[model samples]
Target: MVKEALGFNILRAKVVTFKYQTVENMSVVKEKIIQEIESIQDEEMLNNIHHVLQNIYSKKSIIILNDEQKVKIAQAEKDYLEGRFYTTDTLFEEIING
Candidate 1:
């Protein structure tokens, strides 16, 4: 199996090769990285890696809502504040009886 992370193609196998480095096992890569990190004393390099990892793992995105969507969301919030929502049982009963 192969997985793509960022732009790197990760091969899930006993032996994986990337560029000039040969990793013995994909499962041990994390351990190897941890060991390397533990031995590294360079603050600048570690900080760079920290920032890179943050960007790679971050899931935040900006969602631009249109006027109609904004209005709908505002109406929904108002309805919820005024106790205008239906209970699950009532909604199911109405659906079944209809």
Candidate 2:
């Protein structure tokens, strides 16, 4: 537990997480950001932030992909469940010796 100090005594803890947002709250968030940016006196700093944001926004989102065919993948999964899959060193030895 996360304890905080009260008068030389440990108090209660609180937890926070980021899963609260849904699709309906976009406009309120945008309005607050716009108000914050307008309140900023340095337009140059805002433009720099905008440039970096655009670069990050425009990049392709990353995804990890498995190269195995679906049938082979399923078979390998079954082998794993049945304790029959190979280790990395065994696979390397097979490749080197074969």
Candidate 3:
């Protein structure tokens, strides 16, 4: 029983480690992609990449807002047009000071 428990614990540890490593690997991949994008000088290649990214983004499921959410969004838009919104910097300053 002791040996079996030890084996199970080892397997669980491996699974946990694998999950963490996958997340870390994804971060590394994202960083590499950013670096590659920054280093690319070809405008055509950049445009192609942008087009592919846009297509990927466009395929995502569209959000269907409820009536309450739609009303809130409309109010927010009205406020924006009336210049009732704080700048991001001002918002962050208020948050930090508070």
Candidate 4:
């Protein structure tokens, strides 16, 4: 029983640490975004960023995505940044029309 309790405590500590690390990672990303926004000078680029943020904030419901979906979205963004994504026109022409 004591060994079982010790195992439970270790699991709980791991969960707590995971949650803390998630929040810390988000805070780091938020700080980086703020720093980049402060350094941005182009009006059009800022406006585009503002529009995207507004769209994000305008969501009416709290949509809870599962871990797999989150991982897929992160991977998609990484692929996009690495120039491994398809263009809208190409997608429309090939997948949408064909």
The candidate scoring highest on TM-score is: 4
Give all candidates' CA lDDT scores: 0.75, 0.67, 0.92, 0.89
**Per-model TM against the reference:** 0.37, 0.33, 0.52, 0.58
Candidate 2 has an lDDT of: 0.67
| Regions of candidate 4 where Cα sits further than 4 Å from its true position | 59-98
TM-score of 1: 0.37
Model number with the top lDDT: 3
- Which portions of model 1 show Cα errors greater than 4 Å? 1-58
The sequence of per-residue lDDT tens digits that candidate 3 reaches over residues 10-91 is: 9999999999999999999999999999999999889878877876789764555668999999999999999999999999
Q: Cα miss at 1, model 2 (Å)? A: 45
- Candidate 2 vs candidate 4: the lDDT winner is 4
lDDT winner, 2 or 3: 3
Model 4: per-residue Cα lDDT over 6-77, one tens digit each: 999999999999999999999999999999999999997897787777778987644556689999999999
RMSD, each candidate, Å? 15.1, 16.3, 15.1, 15.3
Output the TM-score of candidate 4.
0.58
| Arranged by lDDT, best first | 3, 4, 1, 2
lDDT of 1 by residue, 7-84 (tens): 354343322445225443554798888999999899988987777787677886445466899999999999999999
